[model samples]
Target: MTLAALAEQVGVAVVNLSVMKNDRARAVRFSTLTALCDALDCTPGDLFSVVDP
Candidate 1:
């Protein structure tokens, strides 16, 4: 699905979703994360990863 479509499904603006897509977001609310997971039918583990920095 397109970002715009996903944004609509998740009840967020396209620009906000774009920030998350680009890894520019500093934080994400649990509600928003849940919405994304529900829309994509995926787990949080599928969407994020941990890295040594």
Candidate 2:
């Protein structure tokens, strides 16, 4: 699915989803994360990784 479609499914703004997609997001809400996971049908572990900063 496209970013716009994912954003619509997750009930979040495209800009916000874009920020997460681009790794520019400083934070994410649990509810939003849940929505994303539900839409994508994946676990949180699948969506995130420990980045060596």
Candidate 3:
């Protein structure tokens, strides 16, 4: 999915998405996660997955 498009749909700036993509974000709000899920037709699990370190 195009983050720019998703950002547009979710009323968030592309830079914010970029930061999230690069793992530079300190945190993400539940509401933002919900908006992303709703806009992308996906779940939080799809957006992020736990991996063994």
The prediction achieving the highest TM-score against the true structure is 1
Per-residue CA lDDT of model 3 for 1-53, tens digit only, reads 79889899998999999998897887899989999999989899998866687
Best-to-worst order by lDDT is: 2, 1, 3
Clashing pairs in 2: none
Name the candidate, 2 or 3, with the larger lDDT value: 2
- The sequence of per-residue lDDT tens digits that candidate 2 reaches over residues 1-53 is 99999999999999999999899999999999999999999999998899787
Point out the worst 10-residue segment of candidate 1 by lDDT: 44-53
Question: RMSD, model 1, all Cα superposed?
Answer: 0.6
Q: For model 1, how does the per-residue alpha-carbon lDDT over 1-53 read when each residue is reduced to its tens digit?
A: 99999999999999999998998998989999999999999998888888898
TM-score of 1: 0.95
The C-alpha lDDT values of all candidates are 0.93, 0.94, 0.90
Over 4 Å off, model 3: none
Residue 21, model 3: lDDT of 89
The residue ranges of model 1 lying beyond 4 angstroms of the native Cα positions read none
- Distance from true location, Cα of 15 in model 1, Å: 0.8
